[model samples]
Target: MHQLNSLEKRAAIALALVFSTRMLGLFMLLPVFALYGEQLVGFSPLWIGLAIGAYGLTQAILQIPFGWLSDKIGRHKVMLLGLSLFVLGSVVAALAESVYMVTLGRVLQGAGAIAGAVLALAADLTREEQRPKVMAIIGASIGLSFAVAMVAGPLLARWAGLSGVFWFTAVLAVCAMLIVAFLVPKSVSKAPMAETLALPQSLAAMLKHGQLLRLDAGVLILHLMLTAMFVALPALLNQQHLAAERHWQVYLPVLLGSFLFMVPMMIIAMRRQQEKRYFLINVLLLVIAMLICWQATTLWGLVLALLVFFIGFNFLEASLPAMVSRVAPAGQRGSAMGIYSSSQFFGAFLGGLLGGAVAQQFGFVAIFAVLAGIGLVWLAIASTMQVPSRAQRLSLPVAVTTEQQAAALAAKLAALAGVQEVTILLADQRCYLKVSAQQFELAQAQSLVAVGNQ
Candidate 1:
């Protein structure tokens, strides 16, 4: 409940704006691209789907490496390079006359992966306690961008055409670059933050954990189902007599209604500690959406199905990061998140390939069947997940000159009352602890670390 100071608020808003700006440009094509892609030479259902998801393939491949590069170079410098690449990709897409060219442009767009760097920068700018709020702000911005893109992308494409959409994206990328240079506050500390960069050594542990793996798989499948569904959705709407230009009419209501339903369910799940239950419910809802798509005879029924799907999508979108944080070991959150993001993007790429192939051979409706099968598998995996822990992680800066000193301090802190886990990272000059808030004595722990600071 602590309020963010002016600096924290500024960093959060500026980062959120940067994130939203880039995502808005990317998502703006989701609702209309499949339809508009038809106008390209060498266009087919398969290539159209590839054009929609090719960005994810390169994004997944480069996401971690880009963040690692940011650590060696300055964050702002990395961001500048990434944004420049993005602008170049947008220009390529704008000039593309064939689906193959569009796919290549999308691949280049994904090559500029900078999400990890942006997150690292946010972590550096905020205190440990305030980082969650900053992440939440950034997360909300992404969700808002998706909703707005669904509506605005179609509208913009209606007037300007698909190429015009890419031109606008290039303009937005330039604006984001300016914001990075001027609006973002510089990090004052050179401390190595576990929340900012992933450690390669931690990769095995992060991947092997049962809970974290499940969550990671869930995200990958969630995005896979989403991208795959969209591959056919635009065409289906055509069957229902809704033109691509008018698609927003359905999306606007679906997003609004889904948000209204999603918020309450999230609150209830948190209050009742029924995260697993609600997560399973959402998975099932996705399955139901697929089934409805498979059998629906009316447009209104399809709209209703979309509402259900969004309700589940929105809830999971909000909760998945929280789930990851809860299960991740102290001091290795960045690694966990990086792996999770890779999985999610990979899902998008695979979904496009799978959906496109199925649509081309079996027909549009069969894509729904394929997605439903995937949903059921996800539901089975999710059902095995335990309820997420409510304990909070606290980071304490400590001075330690040797590995032995750090170990001794870690042992001492581990023996403290209410401390569930301790991780002392000497290189970072910090120790991370997980504890129940009600039982934790922050004053005493702060006193212990304060001596080191002095």
Candidate 2:
């Protein structure tokens, strides 16, 4: 196991805090926004749904550009700018008295678009062996923030109303800014690593990759179902005579149950190297949740349905990025992640749009049917996904003077024990490899080329 250095530890902690804080701000609105927006001027179900998902649209648009800008400027500078935009958007939403303005505020909020930049920075600050652990910590933090926000959103709205939530997020954004400026140390580049920054030119090839495409589509459909479900769920609960303020009581216990179910499955998957089987089962769980919702008659049945839904949601959220990292071609991981993130946000937008429209025209039951259909589509796609190799990403520095030399060296490494794939960057004196954990001999690999994790 690679130990985290002092800087890596500090960076991971600070970055995770920043990420969780930002996500909490975003998610804290999901459960309560629909109810409170009815009091605003020009409010309607469709606009409320659009308001809920508007942030995703802007986020999808700017994620790549912000990351590219971070590469040009410094990471902290870009992060600060993103945070500033987030705070401004929060304030706008806080002051708005109309649904259209709220939609504008949500769009502004999405414009921060810092997820790619944050992940890139995390990659820059950690070693290859330690990167997965660090990323996992950050990913877990984001997931926890979502869980917390789901509970907190309703409770806070009950006490302070919708505007209060926006004000609170603005405060959180300010704290995030302080952390970015003071607590987080500057990242020092170790070597030119492909996974750390987006490469626009590589997008075409990554899109064509069957395995990567499956993961991308999976994330898209997953989030689409999530946002769409929430668009109609609150109303369904209201129809069942559950007060809006009491929704948290239902969300809290179900979220906990989902977490309990999710953690064990993730552990078993990792321990036994059963990524494909676990993924397939989780997708089926989601399908079952949708089916349960389709027939739900009581609040308790709905609770059980959400429990199953989140179990699948949380599992896929945790595993999908790891899958993307493993399957993406070397030197293109960042671009691949950018696309993945964009797809996720875009799905949120489409879900809100489509879900709200469906709910308005038909009923919440129709929304459930639509989401169930989506789950079935995802099941088909996920079934065809390639199982990720049980290898960690490792970077090796080689002494190659020519393109031909680098190519020859990469071929040599490919035949070595434990090596599954290799991509040599002729311009960078570096080679990226996927090596089997049980079979990879780091010492032998280093003998051929001066090995270092990029």
Candidate 3:
């Protein structure tokens, strides 16, 4: 029931716009790129796939470094630099006459890697209790952006061709930069919190966490299937006698109907506390959808398959990150998310590489079969994942100056009723805790910390 204040609202809205615009630019190419990629020099299924996924490779590689860099220079500065790179890449891609140049542009675009910095700034601008709400807004924007891009990509391509789409993406990136410059509120706290910023020291432990790894693998496979599916889906529709320009007609209704179906499933899962059950079911749904896509001969048949696919895809996309937050250790959520995001981007790269290769060697239908197999494997791995506890994390400023004081304070906080975990960072003068949402008392925690400071 915690409400976001005025400043929090402004920050959340601005940051969400910035995040979504960049994502919109990135995604606009997914649906239309394969069809138009043939017009470029050195056009081939393999190169086309590589061009589609090249950005992900750089994004996965540089995102963590850019985040660490943000801590040194400042969040706003890093964001500006990142957005600038995105614009430059878009422009490069727009002007390219060859697949190689477009691939280079996509790689440059990925190098922006501003996701972590943006989230960190969000954390700095909002209170701990209000952070989840802000994150939800941003998450919702991403999903909405993806849905919009799927429809818009084909329409834009019909009007302007492939280069036109890239030009529009460049324009969107520039607008995002302007938003970052003027609309997004600056973070008041410069001190990085482990709950918000990735710590290099914690990376190994997060990598080793079995549960967190499952979620990471899940996102990787999810995006992999998504990108790989797109590698052939547009062409599949085109083969069904649907013109490229008319592709939006199919996407529009299918996405709308799928969203309607997905909402009820999400509601039921949450209300019934059957998230794990629903999660597995959704995975199974993806497998079934892929199999149908592989076999469908008619346009409507493919549409039906896509409808089923999106229902599962949308639900899993929303729920997986929530699972990561729940499974991550109290202070290491940032590190866990960092890894999860990298896995996601890397999966995109793999999808393009593998999908293109498969299409070249085995043809389009084989792509879906491969994806279905991957989904089955993922479902098996995910079956072992334990249900995460309903623990909420809180980070509070502490006044302890010495390690001894910090340790003593951490022990006291750990011993509090309903507190599941406590991590005190002396350097940051902050304490992070994971506690049962229903049983934890924030007032008591604040009082105890205040006394410890005194």
lDDT of 1 by residue, 144-215 (tens): 999999999889898999999999999989999999999999877643557667788888888889889999
Report the poorest 10 consecutive residues by lDDT, candidate 2. Answer: 445-454
C-alpha lDDT values of all predictions: 0.87, 0.86, 0.91
lDDT of 2 by residue, 278-319 (tens): 999999888899889889999988998999999999999889
lDDT tens digits, residues 1-454, model 3? 2488998899899999999999999999999999988889998888878989999999999988898999889989999999999999999999999999999999999999999999999988987778899989998999989989988999999999999999999999889999999999987785345877779889999999999999999999999999889899999999999999999899989899998999999999989999999999999999999999999999988999999999999999999999999889888888999999999999999999989999999998899999999999999998999877789888888899888988888888888899999988777778889999788898888998999899
* Number of the candidate with higher TM-score, 1 or 2: 1
Give the Å error, residue 259, model 3.
1.2
Report how far off residue 242 is in candidate 1 (Å): 0.9
Query: What order do you get sorting by lDDT, best first?
Result: 3, 1, 2
- Error (Å) of candidate 1 at residue 408 is 2.9
Flag the better candidate by lDDT, 1 or 3: 3
- Between which residue pairs do clashes occur in model 1? none
Candidate 2 local accuracy as lDDT?
0.86
Give model 2's TM-score versus the native structure: 0.95
| TM-score of every candidate | 0.96, 0.95, 0.97
Alpha-carbon RMSD, each predicted model: 1.7, 2.3, 1.6
- Pairs clashing within candidate 2: none
